[model samples]
Target chain A: MVNLGSIWQNLLASQAPLQSMTGNATTMAGLATYSLPQLPYAYNALEPYISAQIMELHHSKHHQTYVTNLNNALKVHVAAIASSDIPAQIAQQPAIKFNGGGHINHSLFWKNLAPAETPETNYSKAAPSLAAEIEKTWGSFDEFKKAFSAALLGIQGSGWGWLVKESTAEKGRLRIITTKDQDPVVGGEVPVFGVDMWEHAYYLQYLNGKAAYVENIWKVINWKTAEERFQGSREDAFADLKALL
Target chain B: MERDISDSRNQSANSLTLSLSLDKQAVTMSASLFRATPVARSALRAASAVKPAATFVRGKATLPDLQYDYGALEPYISSKIMELHHSKHHQTYVNGLNSALTTIAEAESKGDFTKAASVAPLLNFHGGGHLNHTLFWENLAPASREGGGSPDGALGKAITTEFGSFESFVKQMNAALAGIQGSGWAWLAKDKAANGKLALITRANQDPVTGNYVPLLGIDAWEHAYYLQYENRKAEYFEAIWNVINWKTVAKRFEA
Candidate 1:
């Protein structure tokens, strides 16, 4: 339950400094113009498993639109912030979210993939900590993949399947979660690796067989990126918990 | 703070016979404050399937009449979107909920708990969809009418207090909305236990905001809500919707 009266009293008590503060600087200042990040490899790089044409369109067209839209929305958002117009700000949210999410997910997706020749089964060596956590949680790498793939296939629409570090609530565990429609994994969960399940991601290549796309994606999985994200998330979680102590 | 559930339920039952009949042009209802009680609750009362307006009241769920013309929210929310959303999308949910409830009611009557348990998801999804959309409709008005301005009176004061300012509140809600990972809704709900302090919360898919709080305003995040008018420029759609926010209706709900 929310105690609005007490909360209002608190706001009034702090109103002096709040009143003194200038136009919503945080909202307006230093807005990042998110650009289309370059794919680490050539369009044809993750071939056989993920086709060149798919990568080209997904990255160049789909991802680019998100970038352009997010930047455009932020301009209005900055003004909404300064004016203190609540409804105006609220109105801009959906655009920022969808486009921002597209940008974030695609950016992460591109980095987390590599050439097919890259070793697919080197999680234990590349990301020892993540591998140990996965092994402890799911018994082994094979079980973890099976679980992850099942979660991915279960998504009902255009979305991403993620392996995230649950750093809050459940704490320091690897969990498989699916977000429909480019919604980023939020609330203290740091994404280690993500698989795009949008039909546009594989329709041209895999046709209706989403499972085949999920299975084949492993051939181009970038374990090194996953390891770094895993290690960083764990460190961040530790710092957050330590602050409580 | 306890609601007179019986009185409210009775009121809903009394209104169960009323149904909207639209012309080919889709002009049928007018925005009036007397439709004070949540139509979502009134919708549930019609689930009895014994109502005179039984065409829509299938086993006890019915389509709510819009208080404004479908074209009333035009330029902000197109008449086409409102028509499709209300007549098709929301109606589908009402039908789904009624069907699910009918199934559950039958199972319960025959002591078939297993069958009842199996259809619970349908109830949660469709029932929640009906409830949320019902609230969604009541929370808007035509800008030319009594809509699109900031809140006033106690609701206004509460907004200022809890959120620092109205702009801050919208900003915070926007941040929350931006973070929902899928098809969902962003809500400005009142927390009864917390002295009516407002809270911003979200629900995934068709899940309703349940327990501890009453939803005062809900912004639908589902693509169907904006995909037609705004397309991928969801920000434009979201920003434009404020022109039709029914703050008076919101204040009334809060005071009750």
Candidate 2:
């Protein structure tokens, strides 16, 4: 019997969109060179929770460095190839990996947050479906937040805590996973949302207070964007499985 | 340039056909050359890409020379930390590895396989520690002039291709390194089996990246590496170390 599902997947994948510049590293490099993604809101947008100063430096200074470095590395890589020096070319992997990951992660981090609702509240404003999913997964929204915060603080050095959907599974399930340094996970699952735990993400105002940053970030989470990400993941789950298979 | 583009397009077409050939042939679905998600197609391309091995020579263990002064990586990694780490910590591993090797050689001469097996753990721990540190030192440069630069050439493209952008790669490395509990090392490794697929991996203690994975760079996550300068503030230490990374050495390793 012809596996129509597989055929559809192969056909779709071959013609699959660049996924735009949604911050996937591998795809970004292929579609020309990567550029720094602009923040959706102003630097002071997530004030009280995330400071304007932190946002400005993170976006302009740190993130820009990654973009600049990545371009430089690519140039060196091109020259290395031209010279036929394979070793020299491969040695540039770390620079590309580090800066590339930084760009990809920060690009997503900017969109993960938004200006908190007025009157200052501590509550989960996730979309209805996402709220329901969180409740189903952890019994309650607060429970999910608590677990997520704990995991975020438990990071020993620098890294990220993610709320990702395992799209390749038989069923799409949300899980909290952490990656060290600038490593980004793609291909296996679709990332619904991610938080950068690197000190640069919060060290300026939060100082050593990772717990505060983790707890407060919830106030500014872009629930609409998250819901969109969730919907996209669900649609792509089958395609992901086909690719993996 | 147009010719190169056409050549690459042809190469990609050939590879895609080869990939379909390897997959379960329930049906032959031929599609236009334009089809395929860039990321997903890259994964398929990886399956058929050339895998290169990083050559390493096993010889007498000795102290590796630092290209810059001990104080070179200062502020990020203090001179105190560098001096102690290299002279004391790494030296201990080198000595231990050499000693273990001597015992193993003696055992082999005596045909005492059991004796050789007994000291195998020591050899791996110390030998891996030695090798890992060797790569670690080479990967670092003085933040002053020599270090803290972006990657270039093939190394840069590999990072962009494998991880997306240099920043994304850094974020992954930082996150993975921070999450590592106890003493361990975080690696930016090239998977030779999957056509030099660059990936971030972590190994506890002194475990080496053996088998099909070749390590391009390693960040030491042990407290001793930064405790003197950053105290319990591991984040600061991790953040600062980036300012001193020797991307050139890393690039060279990748090209190798």
Candidate 3:
């Protein structure tokens, strides 16, 4: 396992007096930077549900922009911290949250999807424990799906819909939640799975038929990942990000 | 601490003096303030230091009144959509812009550059939304009046030379509108750098057209613009909007 804290210390050490004084926010050689994760399945794997064109652009164009922007913002943040520029640090916060959330959300979103008709896409076969928990909460698997779909369609603008496992007194309880504009699920909630509701997610193939997109997304949902996130700790669910570290 | 206190005093005094001046001047002053980059703004601040209590007028943006009724463009654009789009969405942007500007001014006075800079995205988003919607209202009229049909003057001749014909221009504009990946606007703009040649462009989210182009006609491609009326068939909304294009306004902008 990689030492995440040490990696951050190294990042700070590299941005010493010389680099900080120059205000050169560009990534230096040998510097650790956040990068776009490779998709588990081929771009065309989810075809007939999500088109290959939509997958390619969503991953390459949209997600890559988020990763690039997050790196740039983090560099500026590091420089600001070195200078003790409170205002500059505050200014970099929004970009960090927005781009950082975009990266985290897209990274998780890709892992939680599978090729249509696969065993991983079948809740009954791949996610028995999660299916049982969901059925217990919403009364049935179909009811949970209906409720989740309603939450997805309710988003006014750009956002995401998530199924999360509660970590409060109601530990391990299943819940459906929605967040606006690239906001990730926060606090102690384990994001079992999420669906991107940004127009770019479905606009190419679905056009303005958002309901159809919502309906079709289930066919590609990776229930195996959902079950794993449901059963594991938050650290286990976020292990993919740690791999990048 | 002494400098911060003096700065606040000067800012208040400037505000008081601005209140006594003409409203038009106040609007112009605020517009210029919003346009300046952080570096240019600090330079402006340094320049103003010589005259400690000079004019630093901050103005609030108000919603522009529509010449036609909310339901004027109905059947094509529903009264419900127009009312929500204008009263709810556009008004939110106007309020946000005013609040962001106020926050920046207050922050700058207190030497809180962090707060000032943090409000920059709100200023950009709401500012662009306010300006885009202001232009969009004027770009429409009831089909019964001076709406739809091709231009007949120099603007008409230019359209023919640039995009082949009026029909082709409409087709191309619709194509641009349909191609937008997310919430954005598709515009028919005059490319200032290329000697005012007509061009079709798209801006993602509420980003306004800047640099070398003067936007002449813009079609709102955000789902909010047509989702309630046309639903999934946004291609219909794109096609239907041409019936109320207000070509006279486009021609006036072209000539200007």
lDDT (Cα atoms) of all candidates against the true structure: 0.69, 0.65, 0.75
Interface RMSD of 2: 9.2
Deviation in Å, model 3, residue A2 alpha carbon: 33
**Chain B, per-candidate TM-score:** 0.78, 0.76, 0.82
State residue A34's C-alpha deviation in candidate 3, in Å: 30
Which one wins on TM-score?
Answer: 3
For B1-256, candidate 2 gives per-residue lDDT tens digits of 2232233233223222322221232122232221222333333345445231111112345667666788887778878778878887788777876677567545544446699788766766776776677778878998778689689899899899988899999888899987664468999887877898898999877776666667778899876787556645678887888899988877776776
Task: Compare candidates 1 and 2 on lDDT and give the better one.
Answer: 1
User: Tens-digit lDDT track for model 3 on A1-245?
Assistant: 22333223223333343443343333332345788999999999999999998898889977888889777877777677667676686676666667777888899999999999999998899999999898889999899989999999866557899999988745599889998776666557899999999877886677556799999999999999999999997778778876764
TM for candidate 1 is 0.50
Off by over 4 Å in 3: A1-191, A195-245, B1-56
Give candidate 2 regions above 4 Å deviation.
Answer: A1-31, A81-84, A118-126, A234-245, B1-256
Docking class of 1: incorrect
Q: What C-alpha lDDT, on a 0 to 100 scale, does residue A220 get in candidate 1? A: 82
iRMS, all models: 6.7, 9.2, 7.8
Provide the lDDT at A211 for model 3.
Answer: 92
When 2 and 3 are scored with DockQ, the better candidate is 3
Q: Give the per-residue Cα lDDT of candidate 2 at B159.
A: 90
What DockQ number belongs to candidate 3? 0.06
